[model samples]
Target chain A: MKSTLLLGTRKGLVVYRHQNGQWAMQDVHFPGVPVSIAYADERNGVWWACLDHGHWGVKLHRSADRGANWEEVTAPAYPEGAEIKPGEPAHTRYLWAMQQGGRRHPDRLWVGTEPGGLFRSDDGGREFQLVESLWNHPSRENNWFGGGRDHAGIHSVVVDPRDENHVYVGVSCAGVFESVDAGKTWAVRNKGLRADFLPDPEAEVGHDPHLLVASPANPDVMWQQNHCGIFRSVDGGRLWTDISEKDGPASFGFAIAVADDDPDQAWVAPAVSDMHRLAIDRSLCVCRTDDGGKSWKTLRHGLPQGHSFDIVYRHALACSGDGLAFGTTTGNLFFSADRGERWQVINNYLPMVHSVLFVE
Target chain B: MPSVNFTYALKRFFPDLREIDLKAESLSDLLAQLEKKHPGLRAYVLDEQGRLRRHVNIFIDGELIADRDALTDPFRPDSEIYIMQALSGG
Candidate 1:
């Protein structure tokens, strides 16, 4: 299998292709100082990335030929009636998450953002239309500015593998939403979720599920890590159950990767504090759940003691057939061939890795 | 014509002048005046063809100029003009 791993780095997109059992980096610099996100379609050799252009604002670029040449394609074109306040960049649109539609809707695309909204692209990555239902939802007016990183921003969006119309999105401040009839509508599927960040912990929405991993094996079963804790939901998000216990680690982070073969096997790189997103105590780490959230084990076969390093950022860790791989803010890339049980530093003394993906 | 302070990065270009009070009515005039006073000043902020380099910015009393390529922004003598290098280091 000719698998290519597309990683969005501090500089730009770094492609790690397995060549002769070792990974080689292909540097692709997109405009803008730092490239926050990238979308690569390995099959068609096309890619797109978002760059931060400073006071001039954010921009998105498209690469049609294996990332050799690129062209600019910013969509919604500064929404009409959108206020362009002084000091604001002209094209102030920041593209957070970019997904090149799956098989069901090959021509479709989806994007999530910092202000917690969704934009869809039907013609690949050229033009976009905002998923206005979520942005104009009842809670969004208050939840959009859900206050901080732990509140209402959007980073993860999952379109149903089998049916592209069915979409589920996770908001930074809000809980999770489900739209079986595509993003045309949404229902806050946060029952059994305790939005402790709110004055009331039992609110239906606004619970802040930072990451939602819909099992590729069984879309019905999914896991999440949020401000409150770790949870698992079956019945297509109709209900959820807290899996975190006081005796164990309280799930707090922006990353969760489920094993491809087994829906029960999963991993979450938890941090010690909420403020320090990557801070870890080294007390216990690499939370691995094997019994479908019934039990979890703190895997630490090759991790360091208080000295090895305990912090892991939300975008740092990603998984594929290469077991599990993650990069640290300290500019170190780690790979664990046997799940999160052990780790080996592959690339050291590099820039802070914002994202890493393992392609077979 | 207004007094413009250069950002730290561009200060070395004008060794003797921390602030330059040039006589000009527009951004282009101020830039040309500075170029006349400090020979290589324009080259640092502007490219070979007089286009503003990506890293340079011109501000009028704190707000950045929207058009960096064609910066002919009007200015009054009393109004302060700020010229600086665009922030790059993260």
Candidate 2:
């Protein structure tokens, strides 16, 4: 089988092809546009790129034939002449994340944006309507403002594989939220999460979740790498249990990956917390948990052992097939085939990688 | 007909829009006509309410436009309009 990797970067989206046991850069899409996220829906043969022009706001583009050609879609926009409630944002800032619906519902798409809003699309990826229920929730003003530039952002969108309507979203600085009825209404799902920065560490909605992923083998079981600590939930995000005690160092990196067939397995890159946010001791180590975060082993074989200052971002680490791959802020890529027990550098240098996704 | 030109920085997004001569009496009119020729260009320069984007600047001839709200600043038929990104992002 052939594998293609899509990397969203600070400058653009880079595509690499792996064949004959070698990897090479295949294409660069949206050369000068800052891509916050790049997603390839292999099931539908469609690609979506979230471009943040900064001066022009964020827009969505669609490519029908992989990444060969592209056309801009009707971007999610707030209606004209809308009355501004005191708390609602005056205008959209940036489109931070996007995730297509489950296998049973291919036509549905969920989008997250800065200023912390959710938008849903029913017609593939052409048009979108704002999820007003989540946007207008009263807690947004107080909870969603710290992680992003000037406002909060939704960086993780996970759709439950077992149920089409059950969805999950992670907001930076605002914690995790779940929508049981297809995004019509939402509730704060941070029961056992912690926000140590706040006066109350157990607040319901102000915690910062860096990344969240559901186990393919068991959708009810999920893992999260948060600003404060690493957490796990077994009952569909109703409650969380901090598991960072076993995760050595500070347990403070941004990326997390889980095995497809083994819900008890997961991978994370640990970094120094507090003022310095780089790899611990300038050494790169990826921690793997075989007993579902109960215990973790640091994987360093074939990886950098000295002077490593890599800060992996959320969405950069992905579990592809039987392999685990992730990129770093220093523009290096690593891949492991035996569940992160060992690693090899696939690409040493590229633009700052925002996302690294594997398409089989 | 007024002469319109964009800074080299915008060439990445608008490849064929380095220079053009068009008939327009005001900046707003020129932007509308420009959008008709190159789709999605207006949204980058103007907001949803048609106000000039905060990070975009327009100068009529050698002077900056005074009316950003309605863009009613009149220009001569042969005036040269210059559009460039605001210096903030740089």
Candidate 3:
């Protein structure tokens, strides 16, 4: 059996699949405002989700039998009471990005957080230990806290599937950070990127990348939808290039996704600008760039002609082998079976839909 | 001696009183006084060592004093002691 696509929303998580060739909404859990990321491991048969229990805070939940039953999992406390001292204002720690780690001898799970930190879990999704080296890194505070929302503030941790220790983390206000030696040390990779026209230039973290996807086929390659435009790093984020301009249907929201089968044939979810707000307009269309961004094509057929209220959030876009799909901020779900050439509104009723995933 | 103010969450349990403006001195005294009057208010306030537990957040005149070790948080007479359940998660 294949894994199902799980859509984690502000309300909860919903898993759906094509039944009789129809995308059907399955079981959903309203764990308050669930976080952006959700994991379903077919290898070990474990399904886990980090619920962003807003107003209340954040929590981790696990369902071993694929959405059949769920149980509350507390934050696995450090064995010897964490030595983390309060930073100026207060002791506020929150989890942001989470991934089911690669199957190695030790078996590890990784988690990224706000206030900009990372944690690892060895026992599936059970307990976690703060990656001390990354957290205590001299430049971590500068990379993490220096720029707040200007860089979306600490998210998008991409782990190399071939190697568990080899990691690349994206920090807000901090461009691209890579850790070669497990999670011990991290260095900012902002070579070919340009800093904004600010007093503190690096304030916006050169080229403020919004969404990042490492090419599954070639781990050395990664593409990003930045505040400026789209770029790809063939040498694992060392260098970059501009693939868009101030001309045609360009960017605003960081909505980019790569096809799991063909990494080069990826899609860019278009938005309005670098202003960092979701303003919907019918002109917004998902741009597809084949031949690795040498040229592009805009998919605008069968969609709203003018002033459509469908805005895709940074985390609101997803893709499967069958096709690409995204949910609107106005609670409309649409899916396109033919890559990104066309679309159809599959489900029109959701809680101002945050994101949609077409589970296999 | 100053008094303590219960936040909206604490007020949920102690509906009779609006705030815990007690004449007690220490945190234990104030929470004990609230417990004495409101029965389960102490259980909702402190966990064990009179330390503000995970759920409860004690702010003396808007300053958060959740540190557990020294417990040397001082308050002046009529210092507004606000003890509320700080919802954590999400």
Candidate 4:
């Protein structure tokens, strides 16, 4: 039972090592930069690395031995006077997500930023602060936007293994947010979801959740992959239900995986929307749902069925143990011990994959 | 008294950095004395509202320094400085 894989790349963090059954490449941590997210807190062994030094900004590294050695901490900034607007200019432009603080906060650590912020760390990941009632909330300047750069950016940080004070976040155009006393306060869970460019496409908070998963057996059940499609929220998120037409009719994708014990199981890798991000006719499948989304199959025996122009992000898929691992933007690397219906590419060159974890 | 240097593509991420020798007289006091001797190199050369970080640039003896937002250039005393990181022109 030795399964480990942590790849957050553009060029760094890589460590795959699934013993005797195959998978190799052992180490390579933050070697060149761009690792937008990487956490390996196997409960407490600690190792969180989120660096995105493109011209320098956003850094946070910490490794208490497991990763051999590393330091640099104080990342999520914006404090001293932090108010902005009078020309506007604050920072934190990267760290898309990193969550590991449950069982009643074992030294908490929850970061998610870009333009959207939410920091928190109680000493385990070293030092972090900025939670500021969901960063001052006040409907954050007309609901938030910038899909990945200039504004909205909280790339999914769901924690609620049955209420560790419960918490959830997911934004990329802003939608899905919750906090049950743990983060001081926050609300707006985007009811049924949708924002066909807004103007009231169910707008409650801009809507654009790209990918968000829960159901590690059932953390009150949640699942989303939106921008205008796939959604499900069984109550923990207040309300939501529109399984993207049960995974077809062009549902788009940015990755999502569940099934830590099957809250009905799930997975998605579709794509061919959001203005053709690729794969779908260029053929590359991976949409599976186990009676939960009502129906969806398309796994494609070992995957990649044609021309292929891969694209998968949103922490690059990932469901551990009995199998599922993903990475691609073209750097390839696949694995599936069956739950994804046969697959195994493992590594093609190793680069451009931003986030994929499974450390068991 | 100025010397400064730093730009071999930022030695991976400031590997000790080089050409130092600063007495400082602006350019934000040699970047606050190069971040009091390089701890994060003033966030790789200014940002988080302190400005100067579009891709970074800080020449002096060879010219380039139009005050990328309050850097206030002016250090001449054997003046050199450099610091660059453009990587490619537009």
TM-score of chain A of 4: 0.36
Tens digit of per-residue lDDT, candidate 3, span A23-52: 777778754465455666545767667665
List runs of model 1 lying over 4 Å from the truth.
A1-3, A42-45, A75-78, A82-93, A147-151, A275-278, A282-284, A308-310, B1-89
Candidate 2, residues A151-238, lDDT tens digits: the string is 7878888898778799999998788899889998887889999888889998777888999889989999999999888999999899
TM-score for chain A as predicted in candidate 1: 0.88
Best by TM-score: 2
* Model 1, span B14-74: residue lDDT tens: 5665786777777877888888877656655664334566767888987878777678666
Native interface contacts kept by each candidate, as a fraction: 0.00, 0.39, 0.00, 0.61
DockQ of each: 0.06, 0.49, 0.09, 0.23
* Residue A147 local lDDT, model 4: 82
lDDT of predicted model 3: 0.64
lDDT of 1 by residue, A88-135 (tens): 222223556666567767778778765566778888777777677776
Q: In order of the candidates, what TM-score does chain B achieve?
A: 0.85, 0.91, 0.78, 0.29
lDDT of 4 by residue, B1-90 (tens): 777888887777678788888887787777887888877788777875677888778888888898887788776699888988877431
> Which candidate leads in DockQ?
2
**What DockQ class does candidate 3 belong to?**
incorrect
Candidate 1 residue pairs in clash (backbone atoms < 3 Å): A151-A172, A151-A173, A152-A173, B1-B24
